[model samples]
Target: MEVAAKPAIRGAASIVRALEAHGVRYVFSIPGVHTLSLYRALDDSAVIQTVLPRHEQGAGYMADGYARVSEGVGVAVTITGPGVTNILTPIAQAFADSSRVFLIATNLERPFLNRLEGNLHELTDQLAVVRPVVKWAYRAMTADELAPAIAEGFRQLWTGRPRPVYLEVPLDLLDEATALAVEPATPPPPSEPAPHLIEHAAQLLRNAKRVLVFAGGGAVSRRVAPLLKEFVEAIGAVVLTSLMGKGALPEDHPQVAGAFGYRWSPDNPVVTLMERSDLTIVIGSGLGVRTTANGTMPLPTPLIHIDIDEHEFGKRYQPDVALAADAAVTLSALLAAVHAGARPREGWTPEEIAPVKHALRTPPDERTARYVPYLEAVRAALPREAIIVNDMTMLCYEGVRFLPVYEPRSYLFPRGFGTLGSSLPTAIGAKLARPDVPVVSLNGDGGFQFTLEELGVLAHYRFPVIVVIFNDSTHTAVKVAMHRAYPGHYRDVDLVNPDYVKLAAAYGLTAVRVASPSELEVTLRHAVEANEPMVIDVPIALERYA
Candidate 1:
């Protein structure tokens, strides 16, 4: 008997297979007509879970969060035209934060491409829109090119200086049948800094009387943490992690001076450490505007900067010596050199950090005391390994100051982009990436409503992410700005919100409304133990925290 012929796999099916082969655990998407073929193909993908968020922007943010926590490529698929445009903000945010996201977007048929024929979901130059935000963008003209494009996108994620990439697949091509084989493209190994560059850094460090190690987000990887700790210990250096680099070294560690907390007046112990030091070693940070206090903080002379991105070497504050290499590798080399012999940094004792730590422990004022209860409740409800996603709000800055994150990738925020409406979806993505750990999102009333529809997704997936919405019925951050600039004239900054308990019920999520801070911990504990998506609406006055 003749064997049955194998059914032909369509291009869309191959794309799914490619993503699976690259070890993507989930694909966040908002399906439309142009993406029907891709969705149909995805239906049979048992290994790859599909998360359908309410909007394209939510999908993109979810993917970004997944990548950040998982340390893997995050995948988001969207339809042509409006879908792509809707997701642009998140893509731009990912680019700014160095998050790796792979975006697969559908486009009109090749014949209709850029013709201005007004075909459904068509753009004059869709690729042009994505190019500015992504590290790379490619358009596949034929069915066979789909898998290759995806492989290249993954390659970009695995390579140096992680960032988002976009791949456009024409609608007609996804429907076509094609035989394709895709090989996983492993990123090239981390490059080594030139021996002379390393030697120069070591020599300068050797002669320095006061040394400070400034760790950035790039130094937050697990492999780098131990080496970084070793380097700091060997040199008797004080550690000050940037906002993005929180938890890179243990905050509780005696050597660490803690993060430069908020963007306010900036008189933290970290700033004190920077001011007193004669030499600063910047590792794996771009020293961006937010991280550097917009260049207002005085950086000491004879700086040594190490970064994976060559462009960042001299961009923010030029260094006396620069080394381009993986943070872990460079830290290891530096530690070795310090052991070989360096000018001993005398009087750099842990006692010096005591006053700074005391200052960090002190609340800014009585207003900040109001948030302590909620933060205390959250800390009690979750383990140290639990992840927190903070939206644009006063609590975010407070969280940065008070929340003790013990592990890398445990705290995420829209720091670089400073966008609202990100915490909810990003929490979902973080939970999806690490299902065993508890993930909680802290969002303000105004920001939470921006992505309210994602409640449906959280309900559907049942990922057990606890969202704490600070409901004061206003855009508190904007209101604060308005109040500062133009007193008693806060127009369009306040909002009238729907009852959150009823809203949560409508989305099939468990809900509890807490009127006082005293009631939060018990309610949070109960909600977290429920093992389902839940919302805790705290009726706190927004002005109290401001």
Candidate 2:
């Protein structure tokens, strides 16, 4: 109300007011001299909560986590230059994963911008650095332009393909006074699914036997999941989720097979399922390298592809029917179209689906055996509703397939980018976004070291997160690959040590070292009961585990 009521306010105040109008609840921020004006406005604001993170990267990751779990836009703020550069990884990660992260950074004044000046925190082109990773990157020249820039950022964030949006306010603008407030974005709704596209997909499925539905992260939205479930069940199709699509269908559902389809090995059950199927419908996934296991996995012909972005239609494999529209809308139309033809199809039977679900739970090799129990222990210890945020680690690698997730948005991972050191701050953001729910994070000692400093932020803010670290003193993934490729020459794979129990204790957390899975489970239960931030160290050798 104050936004429009006031005749004019400073640029920083206008930015704050605009964010409030657009319903930004929390801002993951690290205050710096160039962005202090905005922080001052934040201090005086009553509605929005500002979170302080140790690093700009951590802040960006927190925003990413917040956005994914909350199913809304997550905002992060930083000072100029290094702030923008430091946040690049998170932006790239969000870009890869299609998270709605809004990044606001300050830039050098107009005269110095795009000019090679040695001013503090100055970059020749701040927008250029993040442009590739963000859906849109903007730099506002005047205080009056701040509101419109924010509106456009939200518009880009909500309208089409979801990705990170960047807006840089100049150092001069933050101090310039303008009585401008951000207006709520009024983007046009996504177009309805095309009749011809829906009819073609339905006709193909009607003629085919043994249909399969390959789902991805884009299929995991609230608006899309129920429609997806109805459509899959209506067609009697077996559901296989890509890593990002893990929980779109409940893993325990009779027809729902988890991420077992990610691997393309001949013996892989889902790959076999794909090979056997006459037709496949892919929804809300780009079918990227990670999802397709670097293109080792194959999709059969007569495929129906549905996505919000038309660019993804023929990026990898051309679909027989490509409906580039909102997933929910497309599924709804497809369901009606399929029902109209009403053909009895012989999709994968219960007998066939059983083995696939079995294959996911049963460890195929000794390497899988090492981490499957850990995920099982975690699953048994936490409720199905508890949220899990994962890092790039050996244990979490197993979690993509072995871990049973029951709902959409309940599990979070940088699955697309596989970025290291994101779980800690990501968990913090998820916890902050959904305070009533339990939040758990699994990290490797290697990746955890990247953003472990964010533990201080968690302790300081009293955000209770069950942080489980699989400490093997090496980057197990890289080491194993190196050892396999080069025999005895695994350089830089081994890591120097730290006493995690002692280290975590210093950060005001209840730190413990668990000796066994049983011990880890018991300690985890206690940590959950205690309802405080904690770190549990499980020391093992990569030689034995990986």
Candidate 3:
């Protein structure tokens, strides 16, 4: 009988090798005694760069942000107990948005694992706590399992609808020596669309008189985007993007109707186009609360819906023809089936869409004029392709509805979770992922303070990112709600914040304060060209937009 020979290597070393083999370029993490071995193992690697974040939660968000823009798996590592718990918010956010991230967490040594005894960073069931939020969670009880667990995590990331995964390794196992043979991950082949369903979708789209195409976040895939553009042009259809789907087609494209649900007014161009359509074809979007205006926005009947996730097909509104497949694959097939000579559908003409486009792009009224200067400055100073991470603030709500983003993955809004403070960290991650492109985190004072610790991370990495903090001295969203409910009785919403300029200086970053649009343009132009991180503080009146 032949015995299998074991190779001699530390579990931590095996994990690093696995990550490198899988082509991971970055790992966002915090250092701890338990994770020292992992860091030491990382020292010799050239492909993977370990980024140290201020907080475990920020580390998680950095990974989340990276995954969202890069369209690949983002990885994060943390120590036991509190370290694992601190990152729950980001895990939940990834789950909600179906973002792909691999979270590597450490546990107590084998002897103390799950014993409920008083120990540092020990929880009764760490795996259980993370299981609900992640698509799958695995614990490595032995040294040899570490590499396999990582490979499995990557496999999960690539094979299904994008979601987060977790791998928990016991401290003793991480320190133990083991021989493990690991292989690089090969993504599973994309699922092909059914020919019958593809034909039906094409026929329905062709027969419809007034056709409207709805592109969701799921439609942002590289394989599907060009196909969507061609289909829209070939069919002579009007296209509307969900907030998550903003960059699926160029917003300036003549066929585009802009984003839906963000602008609550009836005059929203996308809303108007939707009303005129006799049939709608939804792609990639889940029609979630934000996209559907909390279920109040009206959608047309006789719909043809396509999605990668089968569960989302009829989740909201039943489709006349539901095709469950990847957006890129399905859209490609639909495009191939539609003959170029097919009679063009009778829908929105360029003349009809021009007024709607102009109306949506027009300047706001005097009451909300305070934000206009800053918005205009940002639009002018930043390049058209710059990435915008819109934080959850009063300004963000307006920007989400009205901001014109011209590239795919150019604008990232905290879609389902709607969490505050994710902007700065997420934007930092985006900048790291695409160093050639300019990235900006647009945040209000209240939201900026939530993840203020990340400024240190930026100073350490020295990546050029412009963080524009709107200093309104209050959580304007809450203030407005309170005023509506109890007029003149506003309390606790008024916030006192640190002088943002000084705060940025403390982090070794260039900081400037701007008041008017002209000042902002000058300050922002300088920040964009500078080769380091900078902060620009813009003071605006509280509730000015209300």
Q: Which candidate is the best by lDDT?
A: 2
lDDT of 3 at 177: 92
Residue range 490-519, candidate 2, lDDT tens digits: 789889979998998898778999888888
TM-scores, one per candidate? 0.95, 0.96, 0.96
Model 2, residue 267: what's the lDDT? 73
For model 3, residues 165-223, the per-residue Cα lDDT tens digits are 99999888877998988876678888777888777776776677778888888887667
**Per-residue lDDT value at 500 in model 1:** 91
- Which prediction has more favorable lDDT, 1 or 2? 2
Off by over 4 Å in 3: 1-6, 261-267, 340-344, 363-365, 542-546
Write the residue-wise lDDT of candidate 1 on 1-546 in tens digits: 997765667989989989888888799998889989898889988888888999999999999999989888889999999999999999998998899999999998989998888688878899998999999999999888888888888878878899999999988888798877767777778778888888898898778887888888898887888888888887888887777888798888888877767563555556677777888898888887767766766777789998999888776688998888888888878877888896546625799877787677667678777776677777777778888898988778777777767788888988888889999999888888888888999999899988989999888878798988988888887888888888887789778999999999998888999887668888877776787889999887746323
Give the TM-score (vs. native) of candidate 1: 0.95
Worst lDDT window (10 residues) for model 1?
262-271
Cα misplacement distance, residue 333 of candidate 1 (Å): 1.2
Query: Which window of ten consecutive residues has the lowest lDDT sum in model 3?
Result: 339-348
| Better-scoring candidate (lDDT), 1 or 3 | 1
- Report the backbone clash tally of model 3: 1
Clashes of each: 0, 2, 1
